[model samples]
Target: MPYDLPDDLAKLSLLDIAEAVAARRLPPVDQWHPGEVIDSKMRISADGTWYHEGSPIRRSAMIRAFSSLLMHDAADSRYYLVTPQCRQHIDVEDAPFLAVQMEHKDSALAFRLNTDEFVIAGPENPLRAEGDPDCPAIYLAVRHGCEARLNRSTWLELAHWALDRSDDLSVTSMGAHFSLQPK
Candidate 1:
């Protein structure tokens, strides 16, 4: 349960991000109370250290970044957290979802484009929005699965990444900040 952070992503606020996503993904879990719930497989330093097992937590971190958001959104709706296996992970039935999983050895979070507001998992994206360079970027390109860890930064990063690729980036960009509410 020990984890670390990558140099570039060592400075974000995971607690705030996780809180925001919890409110949306796991109402049952979120209702447990207000505190930190590190992913079962990962361990964060109480001393605020950003390093996992002496290595940087990048891919895993990305997963955590998105989970921070998706967990909150997973409530009420039917969505699947992509296992660190394939790209066919998400299963949205309504407007809510919460799923957390480990990053596969190959390092990938894959998802097919669907839904107006969607949570995507893939290796990475290579395309850009049609008009704006400031528009979000596509950093995901997995064929059918999402890889993730519970590192806080990863959850936030992926959410931001999704917003980047989003066609509605103009509208979503404003609400991209992490939130702390009830799931």
Candidate 2:
């Protein structure tokens, strides 16, 4: 559960960590798939920052600002924005906007809510999350339309975008609302 533990406490809670992790991740298979974890966390820091515990890992961010949906076309859709305190070193193939992902989960569309009106700014003089150098607010939108794809496309997009290319099969999920993305 404690993904970002301070090093000093590691020795004090070794056994507690093991039990805590399993208790957090396992069970409920008959009702939920092993991969289908529910909303686990939403934390706000003292410095106007926050962290959401995501499946692949935790996402740490500063509450910059967010975007609103401006386009009517579903294909273009909305974008959720965030500013990671550190430069996220990801696979070269996963760096571009066109290939970024969206996890298939409850309230998967939550990211797109702020759409085009989000950003995170500072704690010090000239305070800004990213300083003078700019980084594009990451876009969380649909690749295509609703009809062409099934109800699970949004999270499926995230799974596919985990790699350099998209998935071969179109259908997915246990019982989540899905969407479409451009081919």
Candidate 3:
């Protein structure tokens, strides 16, 4: 079945958006514990491009399918395409995903990832800033210990939105306050 994303996010309330995000049927990658480990020869670049054996994977559907199986193992600090039988390691330059778009729905900030996945920023999925002060990178926590770096345009939009709410370079969503300043 095709994933149905809202045509107009602004028209949806925070509860509606939350329900939509929670309704996505994702694979149980977190529960999969495969003893076999091998290199998948796949790389997710900092720019959110997926490459296999040094060639870009241009198929969006393939990317989305693989992304659903992606998981990060905090014990080894590695990412893998996990299945019931094996785990294939993959290289990630920075973040595995990129936040290509953002919207302010009700009292929360909603983000659309490069793979066309939706994530809402809140206590469970917080927004953080890192890197140098001059060129800070904003990241939002995605599931399975993964994060998505906000693209330049999305970051700018978020900054503008935050500034409109306050002057301290901070934003509040779902009663949680987030500092956009680089740590």
Candidate 4:
């Protein structure tokens, strides 16, 4: 069977793409090994806003769809959107996606990402805090090595919840311990 590559990626709805990804129907982008490079005027800001040509990418669905294509190149330590035939670089100011909402799951804190994926914090996917001690930033591992920054408000909520745990500033989720401070 021929691999189904959409004719127009921008025209596809985010929900449809998310569903396909959830079903494991897409190819492993990391294995594509395409050498083509396309320069895009796209950048993802610190707050998870996508910008094109210095203007915000207003469509939520478009952002979600593009997020699905995001990949990190370990060889060069850069981020790209990789398709089977081509690869394009995108500037990520902080993280690709934002953890907009969170849920209390059984022994875990499930985060609902901006791209509509729910990730449960665990040993495989640990949370880390970086940056200044006064303003530490929270990040959640998404897939591969890509991470999503928890928005300021969401971080605050997590901090509040962490306070109840202990003074060392760690939380246990799904039988794994994650530190609020960088290790």
Candidate 5:
């Protein structure tokens, strides 16, 4: 899906953004309890490109549909595309989604995923930094035990935004404080 980002995302109120997020309806993949699990022969590359068998899945609508059915099973440490009928395992190179864009407004940060989904960083969906301290990889909890890695540009944008907020390299959203420092 084509997403038209705001000319000035910072100008938008957090309430408006929250309302928009709430308005979106996603499938309940978590509630699906398929007895049979099978290989999907699909992979999501480190760059967030979806591939089936050996070829890339170019359809945005199809990717979007498949993504909505995505779930991470903690028991197996695996990702799957689930439905009421069956569960199909898929490989994720790094993360299921890539955070391509970010917006800071009202002390809250909103991220736009490669799949054109919006996620607000807060208590329910938190941000985490890992890997090297000098160039820490940042990620945001998406849903159903899945995460979205912040892309290079989005990370830089968030870093700049954080620098403007505090010297401690921390930011607060919905009364929860998040450290940008790598752990």
Candidate 6:
């Protein structure tokens, strides 16, 4: 079901947003009409730190709340904190979130995000790496165009699980083969 948000998102508190998400009342963010332009002071750094006006946002709850509203607008090639009635753009240096942990579950790999969301590595949510095995920018598609950059430890774990194929470093998840890197 669609959410009934305040006409002005600025008036909505973090708690409100969190509650809406927790209740699974998110509307299709891509379909939301943009209201008055609101410039966000927030920026997600390469290491998954959320900063507001150059200062790190230290509250974990606030970070999780904001993450619930994150959406990648393919049309604009930008990310936004989307609400039912209002939206605001945000900057993402690498990815909006981080995959901090991983679990090898039977035939699939389940990634746990910093937000505590679990994403199974499969055809719908693929794992990828940009660069060599030693120093790679690893990412896992968390949901709906939102990718989580795998933390260093998670990346290392993925590397250990990857199979060295004839011409690529690959892994099998849910019977689907994913290429990690060209050998």
Best by lDDT: 3
Q: For model 3, which pairs clash? A: none
Error of 6 at 30 (Å): 3.7
Q: What local lDDT does model 3 show for residue 151?
A: 98
How many backbone overlaps does candidate 5 show?
A: 0
The lDDT values for all models are: 0.29, 0.24, 0.90, 0.76, 0.88, 0.73
| Model 3 misplaced regions, further than 4 Å | 1-8
Q: Which residue pairs show backbone clashes in model 4?
A: none
lDDT comparison, 3 vs 5, better candidate: 3
Worst 10 residues of 2 by lDDT: 119-128
What lDDT does model 6 reach? 0.73
Tens digit per residue, CA lDDT, model 3, 1-183: 775545566566778778878888899999888889999999999899999999999988899999999988999999999999999999999999999888897788998889877899999999999988778899999999999999999999999998998998898887789999997
Q: Which candidate is the best by TM-score?
A: 3
In the range 22-80, model 4's lDDT, one tens digit per residue, is 67544477678787999777999988789999999987777767777888878888889
Model 6 lDDT per residue over 111-181, tens place: 66777555677788887778766666777886658899889898777777674323456788777787766
lDDT of 5: 0.88
Against the hidden true structure, what lDDT does model 1 obtain? Answer: 0.29
**TM-score for each model:** 0.19, 0.17, 0.94, 0.82, 0.92, 0.78
Cα RMSD of all models vs. native, in order, equals: 16.7, 19.1, 1.5, 7.2, 2.2, 9.3
lDDT of 2 at 171: 22
Ten contiguous residues with the weakest lDDT in model 5: 3-12
TM-score of 5: 0.92
lDDT of 1 by residue, 1-183 (tens): 543332121222344333332343321322333333333233223222223345444564444443433332234332233323211223322222122222211222322221111222321322122223443222222112221222234335554554665644321222232221112
Candidate 6 pairs with clashing backbones: none
Misplaced by over 4 Å in model 5 are 1-12
Between candidates 2 and 5, which one is better according to lDDT?
5
